[model samples]
Target: MQTIPDELTNIIASKSQKLAYQLRVAWDLNDFLATITFAVVGTSVVSGQDIVKGNAAAVTEWDKYTYENETQYVKKYEFIRETGFPLNSVIKSRASIVLDNTSKRFLPHALPFGTAVEIDDCDVATGWTQSQDGIAPTISTSRKEGTNSLNCGINTAASENTYAQYDKAPSVIDISSIADADKKIALFLYVKDKTKLATANAVEIRIGSDATTNYYRIQIVNSEILQNGWNEIKKAATKVGTPVQTAIDTIRVIFNEATVPASVTLGDLKIDYIRICDSTEEDNYIGSFIRGGRFIKLFSGYNAYSIPQFVGMTDRPKNNIKLAETIINAYDVLHYLETWQMSTGYLLEDHRGDEVIAQVLADAGFTAGQSSLETSMMTIPFTWIKKGQKALDIIRKVCEAENATFYVDEEGIMCFENRYHLSQSPHTSSQYTLDYDEEIIDVGLEPTEVINKAKITAMPREVQASQKIFEKEGASVINAGETLELWAEFQDDYGELPCTAITEPTAGGATSYFKGNTSENGTETDKTNDLSIITWETLGGTVAKMIFTNSGASKVYLTELVIFGTPAKVVKEISYETPDTDAQESIDEFGLKFYELKNDLIQSADYARTLGDTIVYSFKEPKKSLETTIKGLPHLQLEDMVTVNEGSTGETYYMYVAKIEKLAEGYFYKVLLREKVIQSYAIVG
Candidate 1:
């Protein structure tokens, strides 16, 4: 839970309180850009006209025409248009420019050029032709720019190129005068079904004459399309064959059936608009542009205290050009770990829980934040993290081994809390109490699953003494360009040894290769001098073999071989049954409820037993799970403790917040909670 000011607590509990939400996005690390708000009062602030910074007064003709292409940012005030939502106006006005949480950010984004010429807005279905391989073009209400978009569907039997071409009279725009060097086009499309378009070349944009001989084609890859909203594809115009610029009269959108699946149904594609402009006019627009990796902070509160509720980096942003609105979706900094893999393997021998977490975070380029992890309780004996494993997955395993929880806080910092975090500084009383009938808008309680028994299994690695596997009384010789093979079996007590290194008493002139197999007759893998120690350790076995090939001019002799490795063993298993008589009675009434866990990271028998005991104690009996809606408390976070008094059942519940969802425009929060059980732990002074 986030710490809040003392005064804000009283403000949250008030019956009638004001609510406000502020959104700020960082341009980089140090500079934050505020949301732009403007009012349309008569002709003072018109759309597509220059907005003078900090000046809302009537603009003179000189200033209006001089800076018509720029949008000025107002630093300290907001403006609202006096007229209600404008209807049927060529120029569209926006109340505010703020991206919501559901937007997808695009890569290589640019502002709409003010001098761009519209080829087609897809406002009507006429003046377009579709190939016989697919359905005809139709206008759809689902649009990104205008009132409608062009929809095209694929025939189930389409096995050839399917396309929608705008080649009819009045529909084909003349771009012959535009030189190829300065010619560029931008396309906006929304894919209804992504599964239909499976390959990178599923869509293509072609600009050429109606005869189809001269054209420039741009193939769209799978990564360029967004599954949620419109995708903007931009490319420079270049000729394909011997081209006649004056003869260019068609703009074609091809659905390459060779790349699309045969199972694609009708009506799976929608095109919003296509614009043609000079390459030099790319950045002439009237709005701000946002990209990924920017920081986003959301604040919610009343007049006096506006506390930050969510702080994270922008992941995606979706823009509506017609509405002049952009929505941004963000995730906390810890999410970066999911994209990073463990490039280097680690052999953790004697590291604490906190130390392990900190090392992993540092290697992944994150600074560790607050932690309540147990540092002195136990040290990890031996844990091997393989290369290419996800960093987040390894961290979760460490958390499971330590019995801890981890998350990113509101400050965008990674945090870890052990099982005893809450108990270490125990709360004697609830921080806040609420009357269910008055504060809660809705409430419910359901019985949770009961677990009377728990079992845990763990595998611990044990290092063994080095031993000589093979020895020969006579010299074993390999002639030049000849190869020899030797076989040896490990001791019966040590079934499979993870061989770390193989050494010969005397350095043999022949290049040596080694491998371990379960059986002597097993097919041998290709041997090389580059020994992968970790790979051999992972594939443990009993029998061992070596191959020697003579690459020198003379024969080579080898006498003995020795191997060093640690033995892999499944040595620990722990079981615990609830001791409470009530729990046993419930189990007898209902059949045995069992839970089991298997984690190789739990290296100690005592640790496994303690984990099982904790599980059984927590789930001994049926506990109540609840969901309720109450006035929004932005300070409340996941796993925070709260008390509620139920009027209907005349009961009190001390529960932990499981999930929280803001409802009705941030005025209320729908919370889910589970019964909290206080465990007894021995304390030392």
Candidate 2:
């Protein structure tokens, strides 16, 4: 047993001035080692290439590529770099997903399909007044279907020879919040005896700020007219007289009953329940985006393309580098990280407190790893790059093109990982292993969101169709220097044919002839087929011609006239393979969300589909959060893998740390972790 000194014992027993609680704590190299090794160990440099323990050196090259004649630069380097401890190692950081009481689906923007705006006094004459008419209309119960019918008698009609118009103020037709001028407002109503009118257009609806100018008019056609019984009608208002502007506020209903031919007359007209609503299905949200929301509303649901916090300033081209400006490249950044200064032949005495001091402090504070020479000296071969371009932009282009991720780990070191080489095996270090049940303090398991359908975009290589020969399917007889018309339909090629003529002389034993005034002919379509001919050109007009020259007068008969050319480009298609039929059926019933990627990163639709599947399966099919106590580690790192064990079932799970935050003065670490569901690049089955 160890005996404590009187002074120490007195301080421990004293209620005031607790030395243990008052001591300022600081983590040193020893504390770091006890928690997790910040420096690289399993990863090494070979021939100036950074390589991890299980991942081999993979390189990709892109050249001689163009987009609409504009050259593009693309290259990928699958160099495995580790910023955190070995995946299998038991580091101090513990993480899991926090499940909400309920799940919320995210969308891009709120779509207005049937958003309604009611019109006042549409069913009765109380909120309306007739134009230049002395008689007042009354509510007719005989014609009313729902006790909301308004009837205007024959005597109330205005201008017995012209028309009767009922007008409403701009406030009655709301158009203040409408952002899209092209979108139309629809009107729904029920009418009686519209067919008895004299003119073809018995009723007209207009929307505008003024009566004569700046308005749209829609006339109820004969097909939409109600004659014997009541008929419900719905139609979009059309532009009437030339408008001063597209903005509209007032609505007018006009009925030309006095224009009747004297033989036909509408004794009484009845109208019921008029309402205005938006029925535009097309999206009006072009070049408009909602930022800093829980989820970005998308075409079908909510989607956050990029998590802003995880995204860095170096990710954007304009922010990262500028010409004629003193900026640091990745090489200089790495070198600074290594020694906190640029490499020089001779060290300056007053190098301290230089301009680079700010950058050094701004950088994630971490010492150089083992492969500093490899990471700093590595060269990337790109198709094209601007002079003095930002090194991070080059890295981003390469990573995006190759389907890789570029991120700074919690250790403050940049790490690059190609999704193809994700399965490099867990870290071999024994310290990487952790007993989840014993070490985990508390855990939150996000309900898994398993998606069954995925939509992907890819530029798959196409097998071009050879210039096809579209023959007339019959022979034609013609004399030398005489023209004949022939009709033939070509599948894809329509403009012109490659060859001039494809015919043989009618004389026995006469050789076949083609265009170019030579014996040389186009390549044979099939060697096995005897009647194989190349192609024939049209007669410089709408139809193809067959003419025999006087040079070989042998009763020439045109057997075939064919045309040849390539097909149009088509997008590749792919299908998903689901293990659970029930889930697939549910997705089919509910309509799975569309996950589209436009960048031609993957070569084939199959690869794109697989990439989408990998992303959906790995990240948040079911997100989780974990909490753990690490006595030595001070910070949480991205992409750090931690083990979690279920206390009840004893099942183990390996989760990748996607996010982390410090709490209670760095005493605890809370992390948002994702599962390792993406096992392979392609479907094995």
Candidate 3:
């Protein structure tokens, strides 16, 4: 047996179970494999895309393509997704009344009149999904009670609000269980959401498409098909249909309508499930390991055996690459996994997310399996990039146009990055190396984020209360002219108990609650600290406690503390300073003199001091030489030195990244740039 690496062995031997759980999670490479592709998506600002896999419950997340402009350098997100419920290699179906073993229904509302189920757990899926917004299902027991055929739930979109769109995803369903090689059975969907029926949407069951020309287009009605209530709509097999080329195992029931006065909805969809019933529903490929998944890999099979297995089917072992390919291959266009090392160049982990990277491939038109992950020396179409505008301008234009994230890959090819793993940050390499094109394209249209109004609380102002965050899932591409509006309603008592800023300890009534402020600095929300307390005041009751909120992305390290309040400075003590002002010396030399001077200053009679609510002290570099001999100056707190900017002119300054230590997050030490002056710099190792 091969011996484990020393670092692994040492870690295993030293840490207790508790310590092991707290330690940083060692990255497992095989668990993930992908190429930092040059190819992105089809459109600059698109509405949606597709994901196909044999048995893989694949997902896609998207990064909002944004920056100073189309040409400036942008740092995409480099993070992972939060853990969610896992649905392994199982094609669970509950199109009827959803229930637990004991027959207990999951969604009681769906029991009344909707075919409810989380059709897909893809973090990046929408349109006729299992959410309250996507493809929605409704039920009503119109007086036609006894007619057995009418006794069914209707799945339809009657209004624009149902699909959460002026017109995006009208209706869709999981046809993964029905579409097959047989041509006898056609699909039937119920409807009636629109007042007029002349303009109907093409309701068709699609199989597969080959980029263009080779796609299946099906429609419901040419003119008014169903009435106002539940009307049965049928879509028969195409007369020229030749074994519905779509991969039957992972089918997507889709609908498209244009120029229609009213929308269409589906009801009690029943298909020939028996004909396509998969024996075990566990799709095993040709090269999957007989043992656990690690014994064999898919990409290796292509490399060693020259054949590719079906994507999406396997209970992957820990850090197993062979198992990950099933999903990654299927999500090639979606973009959930960041393929770093396994490209045409070599196998690596760190991958970078950027428009420039995708442009290097898709704009040039290179397929993952067709092209070598290790190499991208394309000769055809001549090595050329299609540059459009700047990254920021692209985002603004796309946003204004109601499009998703807009990306500009290498060669100036403007498009949208796939929306595979919407929640996860953009992909990167194992080494955390950044990938960005030096050339940024800006079209000169500047964009700005409007400061949203301060939202008022709705819950009773008592106990701890927080606002509900409105998350935009799968913000994949950038639209050409879209403006996001964050509309919120204000409710006075947004809490059950007293707020943090309190004078009384009571749970209810006028004593505990107080109206919050409406300022941006959180001045009104955190104004409790401004309350006067001259004498010994009890901290137990009605006194409002100050709540400090740090929303800046970078961790802020304290350089010095500054308090603003009514208090007198009894005395001052020099933490560090230089003695002789008219001398010249190097920074190091000045450090020695500064430390010595600090010692003397502390001993001086004018150094007596006491703590107060507010005080200001200046910070300076130790310089008592011809080249730098300057008198010591008072120091400024971190707040006074920098500001977090999310606009045209604001700049973001980093403070430090520390490892868990001393009951903190991790182990670490601060390296001082100037110890005498207390300027500490972080060492990331």
Candidate 4:
């Protein structure tokens, strides 16, 4: 077995080298690594010697690590000369070397256009190769389109293996694209016998590597068909289970007539357009590649990133020694948390039926009752594809809406507690209290400048539902100015027998000129009123109107009061106000800003006001960075609230653990702090 290098094993674990820092800080840096050996949770662990011999495999997690002394953790690391580490902070690491949910390729069910081999219009013998038999195949034009069908003459000599074949060469179609052997494909072709035969063995189709190699044949018994008309035939074939090295090279149509007793000369036959289709309805190429998986290799790498930050947190925490703040890598924090860094997400339907946010977090294996989510159905027709999307995004939305924060505590369980809940909780009962009792090395708060106003603009929700209904209005009558006229309107087609005009009196019936429906060519169906001018003076009538009564199955409504006129346009605007008055004044002071949004996923006013209050509260609790050599709280998590008592005045200040930096070769941890507040009621501005 290969042995580990003496220099690497003897090297001290310190920040003196970049590699050492990674091994100690970002311990779970395998996904971005290459050509290295290690072990992860749920699998076996190997030593540096195993890796050198090329016998080591990849794993998923580095579950636990213990400090060798007060300043060092003697964890084993295997390295190779060709190993590479692309130090990307957000790189994803996998523990095992097995395919999980990644898909690389997909083949569609229906083959694309020109995927099939059509008959050559210029040359009938372009793709086909004649058998070695004495009788050669030729083109038959009895009934032809484009190119005549292929005709293989009878095997006069009664040759056992004589057949006509088509070879798919690499030049014609890129065989590499469809070379997958696991794919099940079907061949379709039209075949007919030129002359009827009394006895024949079978017409068989073969597909595989070559005429003699691994292949399958589908045989059509001669007794199963009549001889004259063209019969469409289809046969299915599957390649071997093991992946093939090359593409399919041959397709053969063997005329197996020699098996018949006293075999007569084979009758002339024709084969038309040959096409290949996926045998299964699904995308065979995608299914084969995805379902048929292989191994995934993971190695060691560095430059790690954290699981996204909490809401209202700064991009970079303020560095102050009093609050325990130090220049620490975010991924180092993730390494300490380990198993507590779990992921969960929910694409809820109607939120009424689904469990509350607390239950969701609990079901996802986090601590129950520590946090809560809003219960109202936020979005209509909510659909989450859920493919590779982080559950943290969902949690972020809830936290932004409900003013909450999530973190894994010292107990190593995910907790979702609102900012208010932590603000009101007793300081003495906190997970960590820094007073005269424990690691209170130094604590100080820094003042931050305040802004007068804050504005949040979001895409407005479409208040109108997706669908609308067209309303019908009552009908109205019209009289040609100062002229005797009869006017009627049918908003929608009733498909009823034509009604006769029953005028108030016989004298009022002024020629009963009617123009109701339009024809296909857009002309009035009955233009009786088109050329006639039946005025009051001409027909001697005070009022001219018609009433209709229909006795038919079809029912319709009157569409308009005045039929021949265009309607006016309608414009609408809706406003959503916040409970905070001072915040609204600031929002309007900047001018009327418009946010044309298409979703109600997040309401803007409350979100903006809450942010404003958080800022105000933040001014009260100054930023502090404490320097401590606290061994017991080595596993402190981000967003964990701890009460800090002043070493001098004994004044209490509750702060959140924003950042942690391990220094002096891991002897001390510098933790950054942020103020926490619980606004029980809505902030006015």
Scored by TM-score, the top model is 1
Q: Can you rank all candidates by TM-score, best first?
A: 1, 4, 2, 3
Q: Which of candidates 1 and 3 reaches a greater lDDT? A: 1
TM-score between model 3 and native: 0.17
Candidate 1 local lDDT, residue 131: 66
Whole-model alpha-carbon lDDT for candidate 3: 0.22
**Model 3 residue 368 CA deviation in Å:** 60
TM-score (all chains, Cα) for each model: 0.54, 0.28, 0.17, 0.31
lDDT per residue for candidate 3 within 380-453, as digits (tens), equals 11111113323233222212111123322111123342212121222211111111111111112212111111
Off by over 4 Å in 4: 1-394, 407-415, 418-420, 423-431, 435-438, 441-445, 448-452, 460-600, 604-611, 620-631, 635-654, 660-664, 681-685
The TM-score, computed over Cα atoms with residue i paired to residue i, of candidate 4 is 0.31
The candidate maximizing lDDT is 1
Q: Encode model 4's per-residue lDDT on 374-461: one tens digit a residue.
A: 2332332232213234444444444444445444332223444544444354422345666634564444445423222333334322
lDDT of 2: 0.36
> How does model 1 fare in lDDT?
0.54
What is the lDDT, from 0 to 100, of the residue 560 in candidate 1? 36
Model 2 TM-score (2 dp):
0.28
lDDT of each: 0.54, 0.36, 0.22, 0.34
